[model samples]
Target: MQGNKSEHTIQKEIQLALSKHKCSVFRTNVGKVKTIDHRWFDTGLPQGFPDLMGYRWVDNQIFFIEVKSQTGKSRPDQLIFHEFLQSHNVIHGIARNVKDALMIVDGGLCGFGYD
Candidate 1:
């Protein structure tokens, strides 16, 4: 649907913005691999792994970002991962768009742009 496409577009924008940050930022892409039985399976990264994981040197903090569309929902694994991050004392959250991602990056004070 139109919403899904928009969501992905915004995700790409967020990725680009993250890449431009002065701090270390990396995005995750889960790919499918062949199973021992010869069938393709989604098994590279752990289930619910965040879309982006990186470290911010300024605050010496590790941040995990799960980018989603404005109307997108997180998977079960993602929720578990969020909880795990919290329990482990790591900073993590779901970002619906570039602005949200910016907030995660520097509390929206760094003026991260999507363009």
Candidate 2:
């Protein structure tokens, strides 16, 4: 939230948080980020990526997250994925902080197109 974060940076935060709970985190590769960076056929072509992917040991549930600063421009691809996640009931969002990330997991985010 305070600094610029690449997908890798978001992934690291997730990794650290998951570690505290002894949960395993899955990080997205640069290639994956580049390839699916957004929704290409949303009445447009998809081409974006998710910042982080992981399964919570406590819930045995998987999450797909896209992090962002509290305020700024959101990538076009992120908007596409937001819709995708909403319809699919997967997790996704523009989180500003580690607490924001946790909220995504605890169902703190709703009606924003994420599970």
Candidate 3:
């Protein structure tokens, strides 16, 4: 089930699960935006930012998730960014499926604190 899912599908499933868990999450589109005149402009976020960002109300904790397919590998920039987030004591992870994402947000698998 995980290996065949697309990143988009995984993201949607994660979003839905998070919503049900009472977390406020949104997808982050980090790329060039096309204008009506055929112009392209940056979205202003640094490259390799996570795919989803949100806050959990229970603890008022913020989280960032980089959704990927089961076989998807993060780019070098994404790894660097994740390291940066870790250095800052942030909650962030690369989630390949809804379960991974839930674990990340719940602080269960990425060494963020939840036991």
Candidate 4:
């Protein structure tokens, strides 16, 4: 049986493409952080932050991208976050692959991968 590409691979491709296209992008690392001085670092980031955050220079648009594999789906928390962003007029979408991600960067539209 043919299997889908790993989400990690897709995420890497999306990041590379965005960078290649001159979009200022970065991945969001979610977890706990403790400094050597026992200083706890926590911003209390909400759940379901997108995998990639970037600013597309062409339109001067900021975006949030949630990457997933062919068979992957968004979690409840992700959907909630999406809605929240929508309410705030933030650009965000779910990208199932490089193409989807690129499209999001182009226009922030969740064409085929978003439900």
Q: Which candidate has the highest TM-score of all?
A: 3
Higher-TM-score candidate among 2 and 3? 3
Model 1: per-residue Cα lDDT over 1-115, one tens digit each: 5355565576677778877875577778776878899999875788888878777777767777877776677777777767677667666677777667878777622212211
Error of 2 at 58 (Å): 2.1
lDDT of 4 by residue, 1-115 (tens): 2146787888898899989997988988755689999998875777877888899888878989888877888888888888888887787788877777787777666333557
Candidate 3 stretches with Cα past 4 Å from truth are 108-115
Judge candidate 4 at residue 3 and give its lDDT: 40
Best by the lDDT measure: 3
For model 3 the local lDDT of residue 27 reads: 92
For each candidate, the alpha-carbon lDDT, in order, equals 0.69, 0.60, 0.82, 0.79
Report the Cα lDDT for candidate 4.
0.79
| 55: Cα error in model 2, Å | 1.0
Off by over 4 Å in 2: 1-11, 30-46, 108-115
Give the TM-score (vs. native) of candidate 2: 0.65
The number of residue pairs in model 3 that clash at the backbone is 0
Q: Model 4 misses residue 27 by how many Å?
A: 0.5
Q: In candidate 3, list every pair of residues with a backbone clash.
A: none
Q: Model 4 — TM-score against the truth?
A: 0.80
lDDT (10s digit) by residue, model 2, range 1-115: 4576664565577668865764566656433222365743232224556666676777777776666554445667666667777777775565556766677776635324233
